[model samples]
Target: MQDFNGQIAFITGGASGAGLGQAQVFGRAGARIVIADVRAEAIETALAALAGEGITAHGIVLDIMDREAYARAADEVEQVFGAPPTLLFNTAGVNSFGPVEKTTYADFDWIVGVNLGGVINGMVTFVPRMIAAGKPGHIVTVSSMGGLQGSAIAAPYSAAKAAVVNLMESYRAGLAQYGIGVSVVCPANIKTNIAEASRLRPAQFAGSGYVENEASIASLHSIHAHGMEPIELAEHVKAAIEQNQLYVIPYPEAKEQLRRHYDEIVDAVLPMEADPEGARKRTEALRNWAADRARVFQKSEG
Candidate 1:
């Protein structure tokens, strides 16, 4: 949105890392901030830090995975701000390292459950409320570069993030008519506490296939230590929202690698230029089907 003054920004995982960075950047630009997270201590700490900066921020203890809790949190925001948040951020995520073959159902449940399921919950819970309010707004989800290029190191994390990338694209197309802008940020490494995400893992998901020791955590921390600062990342995100940009990827260092990967994908696909009749038939068929199933599909234009 072009304006931010007096806008309510509800940020998931707002206690630390990327979420906190958004709270700082957006709050400084005159938006009221809500820091929702699972850790009560972190929420208080984040609130105090924002208080020192004279930023208008409130804290809500939340576990985004719980659909009921997410609904309650939405209600809480309405009660506190007397309105729905115009700026919704789905930024909470988790990661773990293990061989894909060794990864268990539990691993997928915890990692994907938080990473993807949480975003789904947020979208379902808030979209209706925001639409009912009939205000121009924006929704931003934090994905990862691994989402674009799959990672053997963290398969579940990569898979969930990849889904997030596609999900935002669909939302962008669907929400555009409602004056709601949607953007997905596919970031590389960032200086954050995600390395210690294991510490926050609930006991119900304790059965893990990956090793979660100090050494592994430290290794992740060291890699992230050399990564981009959260505030700087937030600056890129702010610009993307203002520009209505679809992809918020600021890592130029990754250009050559991504280009190479995309090239391979293109090489694998059969060029439509060589099969004009087939392409025309396929397009016509889809258009006819979409027209027949109008209620099930968005209308396509000439």
Candidate 2:
């Protein structure tokens, strides 16, 4: 995992922003890059930029939300590269601010579809191919600091980003047997084009509860203007991948904030001292069930 030399990296949203940063960083480190994105023009631009640096890269126009298209992209990767990518970057995402209560199904479908669903599609499509290749690999997913806590203004966005963190956590253990590493990058804010995600909303998902306008999108720039640069953030991600580290939250304030947020949940738990016997019995029952399940699985495998 420490070496990315000649490794194939398939990155979604690779046309611009964070994804493009990853492409540049990883490609520079000797990884063959595949820039997968929905925008053909942007993909061309990205490929050209990578080429100017003499980085080995290919561009694939893909809508990660489309499962069939995702599968085809997977096929295209294998056909073009002669192998599945050793590194998969599920970096595409979208966000729109709206009152939590006013959030529409379309909003969830679009926001969650890209942020969460796209990650799922990438996992489903690539994990099997990566596994079958029988090569060690790494999967890095881009979540947000908003994911660690709920947000009234961007409920669905937060929820979806949160789900990706959980998703990578689960994959970490499961994929370990296959020599695959998983890392979730929960960044606070970045100088990226994500704020303009609303403009990409499709007609099928036009029933948005949030206001989508130039002014609203423009307002986000002020907030993210002082954010970290994408290439600089990508350096942190590269180090995490090499080290097989989990939970890449680089923001200094995040530790204290997450501590306060998680502390509340921890405090809400009823202490075992309150009902020692009940807790003992519940723990025993779960252990017995798990023991039996393990035996059953072993027998089946045997």
**lDDT for each residue of candidate 2 in 23-142, tens digit (9 for 90 to 100):** 999999999999999999999999999999999999999988899999999899889989999999999988899899999999999899989999999999999999999999999999
Best candidate per TM-score, number? Answer: 2
For the record, the alpha-carbon RMSD of candidate 2 to the native fold, in angstroms, is: 1.2
Q: Worst 10-residue stretch by lDDT in candidate 2?
A: 220-229
lDDT per residue for candidate 1 within 1-302, as digits (tens), equals: 88889999999999999999999999999999999999999999999999999999989999999999998999999999999999999998999998988898889999999999999999999999999999999999999999998888789999999999999999999899999999999899988999999988888998899999999999999999988988999999999999999899999999999999999999998888999999999999999987788755545542
Local distance difference test, candidate 2: 0.93
Worst 10 residues of 1 by lDDT: 293-302
Off by over 4 Å in 2: none
What would the TM-scores of all predictions be? Answer: 0.96, 0.97
In candidate 1, position 262 carries an lDDT of 93
